[model samples]
Target: MVSVCRLVGLRAVARHAVLVIALGTGLLGAALVALGVVLIFATDVATVYFDWALVALGAATFGVSLLGVFGSKHESPPLLRAYASVLLLLLLSLIGAAAALSSLGEARIDAWMEEHWERIEATTLVVRKDQFEALLADHVAALLTLLACLVLVLTFDLLLVWVLQCSATSRHRRLRGEDVERKPLRASNGAGVELEAVAP
Candidate 1:
C-alpha cells in the first residue's frame, strides 16, 4: 500500500513537471517565432533565410510542446511517446548543428562577419575588425554553451519519458491485480457451495 502510494505521488509529480515544461517550451517557441517575424521585416542583416529557419524551428517546437501538454493532461501513452520521438529528433538536429559549427574556421567566420557587418555597423558600437572577431568568437562560445545546456535538459526529458511510461505500466498492473483478487473471491464462493452440495 505504501509503495503504491509512493508510486502515485511520483507519477503525479512527473506529470506536473511535464506540464510545466511543455507550457514553458510553448511560450519560448511562440516568442521565437514572433522575434523571427519581427527580424524578417526589420533587420538589414540579409538573414532572411535565417529568420525563416527560426520560424520553422519555433513552429515545430510549439507543435511538439502542445503534444506533450495534451499527452500529459489526458495520460495518453501514444501521444507521450510521439512527443518523445519528436524531442529526440530535435535533440539530434541540435547535435548536428553543434558538430557543423565545431568545424567552422576562423577565416570563414571572419568572412561571414564581414559580409553582415555593413548592414549592422550603424547599430553596433563596434568599429574595428578585431572587435568584430572577438565578438564573433564570444557568440560562438555562447552558442556552444547553450547547446551543451540544452543537451543536458533533453537528456533529462528522456528520463522523464521513461518515468512516465513506468508509472503508467505500474498503475495498469495494480488495477489488473485488484480485478484478479475479486475473481478469486467469486470462484471460492462457488467452490464452497459445490462442496456443501457434495457433502449432502
Candidate 2:
C-alpha cells in the first residue's frame, strides 16, 4: 500500500514537472509575441526595449527550468517549489513591463498625432486615410494579441505552481530517505522483494 502511494505521488510530481515546463514554454511564446507586436508598431524603440527584455526573460526562464530539473532529479520538494515561485514572478514582471511599455508607446503616439496633425495633412502623407486607419487597426490588434498571450502565460504559470505545490506536499508526506519505495517484485517462489523509500 505504501509503495502504491509512493508511486502515485511520484506520478503526480512528474505531471507537475511537465506542467511547469509547459508554462515556461508559454512564457517564452508570450515574450516572442510581445516582441513581434513591438516590432510591428514601434520598430526603433522596440528594437532597444525588446532586445534586453527578451534576453532577461529568456535567461530567467532558463534558470528557473534548470532549477526545476535539478530539483526533480534530486527529489527536492523545497527547491522545486522555490524555483516554481521564481518562474511565476519573472513571468508576472515581464507582463507588467510589457504593459507599461505599451502604455508609453500609446501616449507617445497620441502626442505625436496631436502635434503633427496639421503638418501631416499639409505634407505628402502619402498613405490614404483608410490605409492609415487600417495600419493603426492592425497595430491595435497586435497589441491586444500580445497582451492576451501574456495573460495566458501568467495564468498557466500560476496553475503550474499551484499544482506543483500540491504535489510536493503529498510527496513530502510519503518521503522516506534517498530513494522512494517501489512495487515489490514477485520471486520465482512467489515471494516479494521489499525496498527502502527515500525522503523528499
Candidate 3:
C-alpha cells in the first residue's frame, strides 16, 4: 500500500512539473511575440535592440521548456537536469538583461532631458506637462511589469525543476528496488510454532 501511494505521488508530481513547463513556455512565447510587435511599432531604434535581446531570451526559454517536457516523457533524469540547468542560466540572463535595460533607460532619459531642456521647458508651458509625465510613467510601468512577469516565470520554472528532481530521485530509488523499508523482525515461538511480522 505504501509503495502504491509513493508511485502515485511520484506520477502526480511529474505530471504537474511537465504541465507547468509547457504552460510557462507557451505564455513566454506569446509574450515575446507581443513584445516584438510593441518594439517594432512603439519603440525607437535605440531601445529596439534591447527588445530584440529579450525576444531571443524568450525564444530560448520556450525551447528549453519544450525540451524539459520531452525529457520528462522519456523519464531521463540527466536530460531533465540539463534542461533545468539551462532554464536557471536563462533566468540569470534575463535578470542581467532587465538590470542593464533599466540602467540604459535611466541614462537615456537623463541625456534626453539634458539635450532638450530648453525645448522641453517651452513645450511644458504651452502643452500639458501632465500628459507627458503620464506617458513616461506608463512606459516605465510597462517595463516593470514585463520584468515582474519574467521573474515569476523563472520562479515557476525553478519550482518545476525541484519537483522533477524529487520525483526522478524517488523513481530511481524505486527502480533499484529500494522502496521497501527493511528491518529485523522479532521472532516468537510457542508450542513448536514460529511467527514473524514484516515492517513493510
Q: What local distance difference test score does each model get? A: 0.76, 0.60, 0.68
Q: List the RMSD of every prediction in angstroms.
A: 7.7, 11.6, 11.3
Candidate with best lDDT: 1
Give lDDT tens digits, candidate 2, residues 39-138: 5476543333445556565656566666665665555678767867776776777688667657766557666666776565455244455565557656
Question: Which 10-residue window of candidate 3 scores lowest in summed lDDT?
Answer: 121-130
- Looking at model 3, residue 187 earns an lDDT score of 70
Question: What tens digits encode model 1's per-residue C-alpha lDDT throughout 32-147?
Answer: 89988987898754353667888887898899899989987776778888988887887898888888778876678777777987766655333566776787677987888899
After TM-score superposition, the amount by which residue 57's alpha carbon in candidate 2 deviates from its true location, in angstroms, is 3.7
What is the lDDT, from 0 to 100, of the residue 9 in candidate 3?
Answer: 75
Model 3 C-alpha RMSD to native: 11.3
Cα error, candidate 2, residue 111 (Å): 3.4
> Could you tell me the lDDT of residue 90 within candidate 2?
68
- Candidate 1 has a TM-score of 0.66
Q: After superposing candidate 2 on the true structure, give the runs of residues whose Cα lies further than 4 Å from its correct spot.
A: 1-54, 72-75, 94-140, 176-200
Cα error, residue 97 of model 1, in Å, equals: 3.2
